[model samples]
Target: MSEGFNEASGSIIVRDLIQVIHEQRAYLSEIDGAIGDGDHGINMDKGFTLTARRMEGQLLGMSESLKLLGDILVEEIGGSMGPLYGTFFKKMARVSKGIGVVDGRVLEQMLESAYQGILTIGDARVGDKTMVDTLDPALQALKLANSAGRGFSDALDAMVEGAHAGWQSTKDMIARVGRASRLGERSRGTLDAGATSCYLIIKTLAQSMKELSK
Candidate 1:
């Protein structure tokens, strides 16, 4: 690969992204455990595990891999997160509509596009204390880093830091969305489960892309 994300990324290891999903799954679920129903890990793991296996079986090319992953997320997984995350990947696949390898710029566009998709569906904005909480900051950091001509790994590191801070900041935020909102004042001390998971997953992906860029 050259510098950043490559759409052909799926056409490459095909399994590395899946593996990152696997590694981050529990951490996300754990974060969810403190507030929500605590199934983020289980649901995400099931969805991505199937996605990984499905991609292995069906990915003959880049578009094919992206499409196949979308199908799995839409048709295979269960629960609220299935559609949400499934949509994220499906939207991400759009930026690489043609080729297989997605370079750093392509990956950045994909992430930015995916974030838009999530925002549209959920109607969550920054300070909503949802996944957007992590996404917006992380993406802005990436945009600034990319504009500065920073390398992929360096930009990714900045993203990780931003994501972590975003996740942590949620602890101080009131629940403006999701089931946690039911808690009212009681929800103040806990981090937004979705935001935290979003951070972990995005952070893991950035790190993975950094490696791919090398």
Candidate 2:
């Protein structure tokens, strides 16, 4: 869980976002190798790399960076994940609007927006063993915490727990969606590759926040 959003302007820089996005590909690759195409990592890295190249030196504000990144992801990234993730970041960027920085409440909102996009685009619900598993519950929990007026740190803590719980739920899910679904019952014991990657990437983001706190 992260503490209240730091009002500091550099809460997250554009360069760091690109770096993290590229790094996420490596993380995805590692996870996917266990049960899926193993290219999830490569796909994400390419997406972010393309995004970085397109932006060049133009990423001044949070909105500008994210908006440009979103279009690049949707247009350039060559997978189902591209549109889903593109939609997610786009929604986050939209929620951010012009705010240079946001509090934890907005963080929760951004996550929910992404989750909704995945739901609409992927047409998958819970038990489908997609990234939705990792995001849906996290956003739901965050919404609850936000309504309760919990501190930003406490709310984010709940989100972490929700994320992990969702990640775990994937193990029992028979892959009803994605390429893994072709294996049918064979996919039951293993976690959804996409879900696992989502968990890892989100965990990395949380870890980054923790480091920022220090």
Candidate 3:
């Protein structure tokens, strides 16, 4: 059987995600400034920082930690990001609630749930130059890799690659949703802030999963 990571120790993955968001907070804001209200990173950092504080000294399992983060994002944060990311993590938590190990199949299921959850909350589509662009591709890649019998680490690598490519693809897309959509063709030159953040989150998760699998 393929190797998997213990769900009990997977809280570290959430910690790593928080660290990356904190580190890239300013950069994410910069990306948002180009076409958004310029508060994407700031809001994200605030919520994630709060999550970190709330989790301090606590050793929760992956599902529990995800639930905490999701609840905080939905309750404490404002703007569209709050609900969007909250649903994302919450759906993931639901999928992984009782799993002993997070193997490729479990990870794929988690990604699918998160992706679908986001879709249910918004009207964004693949070419809409939204976070869906990054998330959809990543989920598809992971699903493909898992179905093909690839190792968990390799499937994660594929997921990261898909996310990065999707993120990059947003730079040349005319925004079809969000405030950036108001820019019309002018939005084509800048990267979508949501897509960029989605890419970073997926990349961090993939990296953490790879290490845990090792």
Candidate topping lDDT: 3
The positional error of residue 137 in candidate 1, measured at the CA in angstroms, is: 0.6
Per-residue lDDT over 122-209 for candidate 2, one digit per residue giving the tens place of the 0 to 100 score: 8778888888888887778778888998866667677888888999999888878888777788888777767876776566555545
In order, what lDDT does every prediction score? 0.72, 0.72, 0.92
lDDT tens digits, residues 38-88, model 1? 887787778768867666555354445655666677788856676667677
Please write out the lDDT profile of model 3 over residues 1-214, one tens digit for every residue: 2488999889988899899999999999999999998999999999999999999999798888898889999999979899999999999999999899999899999989999899999889999999999999898999899999998888888999999999999999999988899999999889999999999999999888878877
Runs off by more than 4 Å, candidate 2: 1-17, 24-27, 207-214
RMSD of each candidate relative to the true structure: 2.6, 2.9, 1.1
TM-score of 3: 0.98
Residue pairs clashing, model 3: none
lDDT of 3: 0.92
Model 2 poorest ten-residue lDDT run:
4-13
- Candidate 2 collision pairs: none
Better of 2 and 3 by TM-score: 3
Residue 38 in candidate 1, Cα distance off native in Å: 1.8
lDDT ranking, high to low: 3, 2, 1
**TM-scores, one per candidate:** 0.85, 0.84, 0.98
